[model samples]
Target: MGASNFVQEMKEVGERLLLKLQRLPQAEPVEIVAFSAIILFTATVLLLLLIACSCCCSSCCGPAARGRKSQVQPMAPR
Candidate 1:
């Protein structure tokens, strides 16, 4: 049921997008190429920033704990 609802929503969104596109004026070849390039460049920059942020802010790459002592001492030899 959830899947069907999701599909219906997607279909509606697709229909709306198609209608919007149809209402838009046709673009020249040069304009289309320029628009595509701009979109690609923006996407590339955003993706790169996302990757950089993840690497910088990730726990695995974060700074080490300062002045924290381990509570568990080493086990005595048997």
Candidate 2:
């Protein structure tokens, strides 16, 4: 509530934060390399999946126009 009390509280909070930061374990050096490899692999897989879907859609759906003509011809002779 008072200015001194507020300043003391802030100082105590800052010290606690600094202590916690110092106590944290050091990160392993290989973590960045491993993370990069995982990201690259994921991007490659997503690109491959997009290409496959596009190929399948074009091959299977684009021929529907030709397929409808053939089906209609058989019914006309009947």
Candidate 3:
């Protein structure tokens, strides 16, 4: 009974939200394109951030920076 009541309330809220949204002005083609571009850019940025985090989190520092011995080359005077 409680669950049914909760579901009914959610349905009513959804219907009300839909009615409110229907009253809003329709999107112009330019606005639609702009929104699409914004969403695409946001998704791209999120994907890049996820990739960077995955790469960075794999090691304490990074694979290249892991205290490996390197040759100390004397800088040649140009």
Candidate 1 residue lDDT tens string, 1-78: 999999999999889857755754686777667767866998999999999888877745555533344688899999
Task: Please list all clashing residue pairs in model 1, or write none if there are none.
Answer: none
lDDT of each: 0.77, 0.75, 0.79
Cα-based lDDT at residue 61, candidate 2: 79
Please list the residue runs of candidate 3 whose C-alpha ends up more than 4 Å from where it truly belongs after superposition.
Answer: 1-25, 61-78
Q: Which stretches of candidate 1 lie over 4 Å from their true place?
A: 1-25, 59-78
TM-score of 1: 0.46
Tell me model 1's lDDT, rounded to 2 decimals.
0.77
Write model 2 residue lDDT over 1-78, tens digit each, in one string.
699999999999889857755654554657556655766998999999999999888877787745765433545564
Q: Residue 44's C-alpha lDDT in candidate 2?
A: 100
Q: Which numbered prediction scores highest in lDDT against the true structure?
A: 3
Give the TM-score ranking, best first.
1, 2, 3
